[model samples]
Target: MSERITLGKTFKPHWVWAIAFGSAIGWGSFVLPVEWMDRAGPMGVIIGLWIGGLILSLVGLSTGFLVKAYPITGGAFTYAYLAFGRKHAFLCGWFLILGYAAIVALNASAFALMIKFLVPDVVKVGLLYRIAGWDVYFVEVLIASAVLVLFAWLNIRGADATAQTQFYFCVLLIAAATGVTAAMSFAPETSFGNLLPLYKPGIPSWSAIAAIVAISPWAYVGFDTVPQAAEEFNFSPAKATFLILAALVVAASHYSIMILATGLAMPWLDLVDLREIWGTGWAVQQVLGTAGLAALAIALCMGIFTGLIGFYISCSRLMFAMGRAKALPAVFCRLHGKHGTPWASIVFVCAICLLAPWFGRSVLLWIVDMSAVGISIAFIYYCAVAYRLFKWTPTQRAPAFCKETAPGKKLIALAGMLCSIGLLGLLLVPGSPAFLETPAWIALGCWVLIGLGFYLTLAREYCNTPKAEMDRLILGHAAA
Candidate 1:
């Protein structure tokens, strides 16, 4: 917790944007694009994604405002502390821990699934007991473990190295995706006609779109990672909002393009019914053959790699920030001396990820899918902070902490809050299109119990500490 031990400030604007975009676009765009199309047809998916993106933009706006105001590492954790206090900050950070670390593990797990598809039974050796129907393989577990170690090492090397690497990987991932998209558009075997029935039959069109929109909380999760790195930026914090907004725009477009590419490659209706574990990959391979497969393989690897690296940067930073404030073990604040990185926090995340593949992919999917509820909770905190801090009467000037309180800012914050509530309802309310399944509910219950145990321990330890000390550690010079 020494002030001298800090994360290195080496991230540039594009590097920050890369971390946001890459983290957001990872494994899902490749594996789930066709699933999204099947649930909600091509147009339905795109429109739903944009609508989600637009709403997430409002959350991003409030998040960015606070990023500039606090200019710190913990993102929502620190934001909640500034706006509320210790209990609320811990509430925000605990859920965020599940959401962020689960994604890093998801990306690692995805690498195994990708290889299994490409090699076909080569790595499916040594069948382990099935959990939730996903056959856990010894070789697959090792593959995922290797990915976890690789990215963990990269993050331990420091933010500058990790962020720059993520930027390059982002370039490769987007280029490969665009290449396949162009190839699909011009291929003699494909046509726009295949994209008909833009909305899935059987479900009402609005319901179909709602299904996609409901998951937008998960879809656009990465853009918020930008704020976690605010303390490590070499550039002015004023640019943080635009950088996050731009990354979100690209993320939405990337998702839309992938969905379109999947539909364009084959008849959407027929392709969805085809028995394939990865419909998007299968569609691309069918249309472009080996070349498409190779390009897409590159995209998948880069996407997963970038995701692992980006989230490693964000998740570890969150722990480091929390530890610095004694919300977590103070050991998490320790950094690698030579690299000036949060090595302890990175290792903690690595340890969690290493054990994840053993649980098998199905359980991981249930856990990861339920992660949306956690992130939506974060969105509620951020916008609620914005609404409370910025909604002063027009005749009165806004507080010093609020740099920009444009007209209707209050309404925008309210809309963002309602949108977040609506998303939570979709996931938590029974019979909603995106309601949590039984397994996901069980997973969420476990996480809540675990977090409660930790929080009570921290509370007992910090109960006697003065509020001013907590403020100084969490907000630094930004403490009011």
Candidate 2:
């Protein structure tokens, strides 16, 4: 069988590779650790990210294995269906959609926040004040929405077109962020000694390490998103899985190095009023000063643009897959007449993005809480499935990229399970009076509880009723 399949003018490997890089190293790596580092301080942030990154490595590898086994587009939802059952699969899909949608909203909110920093004066005055809040930016929202529409069109027009865009943008973003950050760090005023024993006083306990570790995984968030492009890989899923795992390792290293360099240059102590002092423009100004600040704005604009495109693409794929499997309303699964992309799903995602403005400053916190738990649930599920597969499914002659699912497999799965569980607990801990106060964990619990309530009331038929009838009932309700 030939390895490649055409999706519009888009080539194979291109889309997969683009998403692999973009999804793994998007705004998440660039911005998340900065926020978390402020909380953990430099040393705690470093150690927590190291441990959290290791946990993500384990999950990423397991996801790669699962993708090789079944390289479908729905990611963990696909795996959850086969390993668990339809009910759990639906829950997985629901949470996955919610998680990614939260990401879109988060990015848009970040975009607006960045704009407020860049042009705070104009936004605070006269006509701008009437529409957008004082330092509340809606211009960025409009721009982000426009980008979403354009990318949606491009994605439908040709997968290749979208992939090409992703590749160039990914390279541009990585190089820009890295180059400017490095330039800023190497300035004569920057201290090499600031890297030593950087600490902040807070609730310092071994218990807090777990909390730090819980939050730490946010840096490694999108590593699993690579495997979502499993169906588009040119190589066998086996080889593709290895490449993805390697990417996670490289990405984690890149993040660690960037933070280390940045910490040395602009120690956490000096970052107390980082937001008010540096604002969203901190990263860029750290290197280029005024000239650098302009460049930083340009880079963030691009970063947000690319992030939206990738987010829409992935979420659309997910919704499309669910619809195709009759797990969601069939209309969402519809393709464009000429473009062959999931038009309905893309539109739905855009509609969802409109709600982004409501989140305001709390966007990242919400995304962290929304993503951490749902993803952890998926990770735990994958671990369980891998455990069962290792025990029940005999290993055949393996592909070179496939690791031997020996006793080590079980151990790794166990470790992943424990880590996820522990992190989930720590993340749920309420922030103390002195710390950064975010209500996302509570919000996520409320959200999940609502989902569970819906599951009990309406979705019970999905589990109890006949398959055909269940699909019909589910679709009918979703459509209604």
Candidate 3:
């Protein structure tokens, strides 16, 4: 195998925690409270989301178990290849790449949305065309594009710098959100009574709760990001699963706090029906006046930036692994000599997201709805690999890390696998509340078609390479 560089060990435990926690929270927790409440009531949203978090805890543990078994980059991609083969790896990477890219774009476009709300006239300059009731504007696009470039550059700079930045951003994000939650508690206009009509009327309380639980896969996605950075951990591999599980708890709490805090600022029913571009922001403004809005702005911006950085790190690292394995053109395998970051992959992700702002807000909502299915597919594959390898396969074939595997780890893997499938059914089934709308279906279809074209082109190249050689490239000389 031709020699290739690897990412260095620079991530501390806290840094990995920040990446997972921050990525999982994102801007969704801050901005989507109103929408989440609309789907499920305020209390229902919190209960269902927490329930989803607990479910995803199982998935995160399964993923972390695999991280220890492999201790390599590429995350689910590497796991898929190990469990199946090259073609499966390509399929996994194809789905994951879109999920990662769409999220980066989703968060980037969200930053623009926040900016538009803060200074409506400021970002409204030079209005462009509109898409699905969302007006596209040059200044808003510029703001979003600029942040995309900035984050891409930071990621390419090095893992050390990027991880440190993520930690501080994560801290500020939590603090900002907590500030609003605390203010809502003391605000004269707020009381427990404001939380009345706990579950949306006409919808069964159980159904409302189950509806949000179904979104657990997407809601808790950032926890899996820990595996993508396992290759760069300065700590022991044994600590990975704990970090992921802990991050999920924090992420779920952060989300719940935001939802409850928003709901308390005003009667949730009144808050839910508002047509304001940002009822969440507007609600916060009402509670603490401008100070509350400022805190929210800080939280939203930090959420966007950290999510952008965390996922870019994951995206570039996944592509780097795939490229090194010859699943992608080797261009992505190249790293900066000084920083040891995947410069090419970062640039590619940044370039794709740069167009997101121009696509308008519809792109943000549609892509997220579409990407959830792709990432859930990833969850299925990862858990399948775990179940097959640790349970059914001969024990001798297991990695050294698996020698002391937990008693019920296999069953947990099975549950994770089934849960992911349920998540898919919830979104794709005809009558489900979480069903993708027409635009999302169309967006998802385009991504699959694009992936198919790329796969056929690369199939010839993948075939020419032997399995042993591909393993060496992807797992390196240390691989058994």
Candidate 4:
């Protein structure tokens, strides 16, 4: 087996937390509340977020345990490799790569969309061909492409630069969110009356709540990024585990606060009819005028930028891990000598981001929804791996987070697996509220087929190798 090229350890403890938090929150904090409330009602969304958080916390515990046991770059892929083997690990990595790449593309499209909202003419300046009912603009595509290149360049500069940028952006995101929440709370327009009816007249409350819960994984998706960079964290394995949980708590709190503030600021019925409700920003503007909106927009733009950066960090690392395993082209595993960064992988992701805007906003959204399904599938595998690890591994070699061999720990893992399975089923089953449209489902199916092709080719090449040699080749000696 060839020696694996490893990523540098440049992410400090705080930076680890920042990446996880920033990635988890994203633009969803600002935009999702309106839709969440629309579907689930104000109180229903809050309760749904809380329930979702609790369920994800169990998944986080499993992830933390695995990170401590094997602090490697692949995150879920590494765990799956150890628990199952090469073929299963490749499948896990393939799905996760799709999930992370889809998010990066989603953020790129969002950056263009947000700019269109703030300055409408830029998107219309130079018209491009339309796609899927939405107009494609040349300038909008240019902006998205430029932003993608800028962030990809930053990542290629090295992990230290990426970590520092993430830390600063996260701080700005938190401060801006706090300021908006405070302003909304004090405004006379903000009233609990807006939250009076917990559900819409015709919609069943249970269905509404279930809808939010079904998409909850999207809200907490980035927490696993911490584990993706485990080998690059400049800290103890235990601290890395703590950082993952801390990021989840921070992200959940941020989502809940934003949703509550948006609800208090305006009546649900008033905003329900509009295609998009500016929500918190509009509420603040009603009281404080243009200045408040300006502040909120700046904060939101910052949030979007941070999200793009966070996901770039994650997807690049995933590609790097897969490349080292020979499941992908080895070019992806090569580091820039001076920068100590995965230049090829970062560039590959940026190229995808650059092309995403041409598909238009509606198509991009479908991709994002499909990505959620991919993430849920990966989570189910993660939970199963955690259960097997805890049940069979010796205490001395088990993750530090798992204090003792107990039935309760095993149960948590089981619950996480079952919950993830239920969520995946909700997304895939026809007629479920969470079921994606035909096109999105088709896109996801095509992506999986491509991954399978890659797996078959790689498996054939390694077929003649001994089992031990194959394990070393696929899992990497560093992880073992």
Candidate 5:
């Protein structure tokens, strides 16, 4: 109800690219390529990513247009509210929070996993109970907990702090990637022959490529973070829209190069035989020795750190938006007096991160797989909102850059909706490459039930209030 609770304008134009690109290229960039290569090979990885990128690009286009019109903090949730209603918005925000929280947990677990590789004894310091085949250690959990608190503090300090950190990490990641690509290109040991076998043995071509496509949403998840922080961006809507597109392009290029460089550095069969899940690092060590491997580790750490920061920013803002709308408690909407950051939401995200370590590293993959489904669900809502917004009367529509691009925007919205539906089908259909396991489905169901409980209990009071009174109490604006 107060102006003080609103998010401040602090993010610059470049930070848009940094946050989105940095988030998209997180832990997955470091570890998933081997799986991608194993499924399809270097060419398959490239082609699959390009295909997935094209689909997500449509979703991105719809997101860009919607953000330009609404320019709100909630991203998909806000769009859903405008097009559908509060209930649909709540469900959309609920699933998105699950996806964002899961990602935050995944990155925290990855940081621990990476540290275990870099300094194997750190996890051995405090022997904790093992769950799902991962040996949980007190020290490993402590380190992850510490990282969560540190990132939360940085975000609580201000959006500028988060953006600055994202920018630096992204730059370092790009520089390291470029160095690796250049080094591998000229290295005597590097050979195109290593990439000779383009597909894994016994796997059908379409199935292999489809496997990569199934995971595509996880690879390009960060671009939507731009819209999550739209209110904080210090730029025109059109510039913000272009930044989203540019970030996707940059992310796609970085992923392609990284996959290619890793393949060039070593024989795929040797990489498979090494049994190193961190194949990218192993490849760097093989090609450039320990020094290069150290650099690669640092770059990878930067990637994970940026991801934690970027997703924290997104999660906190979404919670803040939900709180401001009175879908959750007002405490979540309350901003820090001096810093103007969503302190409560940051702490809430930190709490979720603290719980993740107990599940161990193996569970992190399940979390990532589950998050892919949750994210796709949110995208479906976003596409639907885009479609509805495009059809709204001039007087009902918010100011947007859609005037000249109306037809294009409509097509993108339609395609995004269809593609998102198809993705969901891929995840749910039996025997589909992307189909999630039973445990993962159960976990997702539990999360959704928890969200439903919160909505039913906390949202009722706000729903019962008069529309005018509710707007004033929640948004500090008149009802539409």
Candidate 6:
């Protein structure tokens, strides 16, 4: 009976073990610096180990509660569809693809930059060609593009390989980061007090609040990926939620340790410059010397490679689903009969990702923000759907978590939506000063326009026909 289900049961119903871990490291690694700078300061950086450790666990606990209640392959997209009609579902899915793709591109680009940094010889002919009294790396596009391709290929080959590689790399990263921090903290030259905050600052000031708001809640970004593996988990909601919560705790611990070690080892000024923030290779070099750095670089490459593969797999699946719905070219919906993979969609997704890095110098940075904003919007839509399910949907049953007409569930859902909406709104504000030059609103509008156009085209015939004629025609056609 289960074999006849629409979802493939070949793969066990386990939360995406590997993808989740990769996302944790990839998303949390960079976010550590951002969060450390804002919430911890120099002292906050060191103390972030303890404070952030606690905070992330709480967040994981909360998210686990919700995720257990709803487990579906499309993540929040599936939830939105069930509660809200097809229109809301379509937008959420579209935005999610855009967001995840952007993030994958950005991460690839960053990985490339790190590679060049660790091995100066990787790029030949480094000359100071001063353009307006500034030196820029000339081979930016070549390096990043190469990284994207390499990762995409790795992902297309297999999922199991990707998972194993990521698991090992994660272990190494944690080890290397730990070693660096331990040395820094214990070194006679190092003063741990400098890394400690004077006080908690009682209540945060408006300015401080603004900084936190602006910093982006990256700590919470990849939680959406949880639901996408609904069909793959091996447990009930209770068990799945437990696993998710466990992963988050481990992830939080790993990141907090790294941030603390980094703060203790490097000066505040040293850490502030994004360029100075070394990739896994350079970071290892600084702590463990040349040989250590080389080993770390290899590990870093493996990690990045796996990340690319995971992104390709998930995004292609999404695109394939969309294509099947005729939201995209039907060609993308075609699958490899033997391999059982969406080979066409994979190629298309990888090709699109390859092109994104060509958007000039700020490609990586822009990609992250673009993707982040898109994901936030998608989350807001999800929250809206959840609320609707709890409110308007007469047939909707309360999940195990939210059973009664409890005001608390309503508040949580409302808060989640409001928070997501507020961030998305801020991103879209034209006059609002932000990190990027292109207005967020413009980018968002473009995505919306493109998605809506496809949707209207797919539903055009039905939308144009009158209700009486459609009913009569259906009846006549059936009788015939």
Q: Rate the local accuracy (lDDT) of all candidates.
A: 0.87, 0.60, 0.85, 0.79, 0.81, 0.53
- What tens digits encode model 4's per-residue C-alpha lDDT throughout 322-434? 88777788888899999988899999988877778788877887887788887897788778877866644354466433344656667788899999898888788987877
Off by over 4 Å in 3: 392-407, 477-480
Q: How many clashing pairs per prediction, in order?
A: 0, 2, 0, 0, 0, 9
**How would you encode candidate 5's per-residue C-alpha lDDT over 211-285 as one tens digit per residue?**
788888878898999889988878887776688788889888988888877888778867876778478877878
lDDT for 465 (candidate 4): 51
Prediction 6 global C-alpha lDDT? 0.53
- Where does candidate 1 have its weakest 10-residue lDDT segment? 398-407
For model 5, the superposed segments whose C-alpha errors exceed 4 Å read: 1-4, 392-405, 468-480
Instruction: Tell how far residue 339 is off in model 1, in angstroms.
Output: 0.9
Tell me the TM-score of each prediction against the true structure.
0.96, 0.82, 0.96, 0.93, 0.94, 0.75
- Model 3 over residues 1-480: C-alpha lDDT tens digits? 578668888899999999999889887887888888888898899999988887787788888888877788898899888777778888888888888888898888888889889899898999889888888899998988988998998888888888899999999998888988998888888887888899999999988998898777777788888989989998898899999998999998899889878888878888877867888899888878898999889999999988998899999999999988878888998999888899999999999888778888876788888889989989898888787656443554565324344548888889989988888999999988788899999999999899888778787877678767777777664334
Error of 4 at 229 (Å): 0.3
Better structure of 3 and 6 per TM-score: 3
Q: What TM-score would candidate 4 get against the native?
A: 0.93
Once superposed on the true structure, which residue ranges of model 2 sit more than 4 Å away at CA? 1-11, 32-34, 125-137, 202-209, 265-267, 277-280, 283-287, 392-406, 429-438, 449-480
Which of candidates 2 and 5 reaches a greater lDDT?
Answer: 5
Candidate ranking under TM-score, highest first, comes to 1, 3, 5, 4, 2, 6
Clashes of 3: 0
Each prediction's RMSD over C-alphas, in Å, is: 1.8, 6.1, 2.0, 2.8, 2.7, 6.5
- lDDT (Cα, 0-100) at 18 in candidate 2: 54
Off by over 4 Å in 4: 277-280, 392-406, 462-465, 473-480
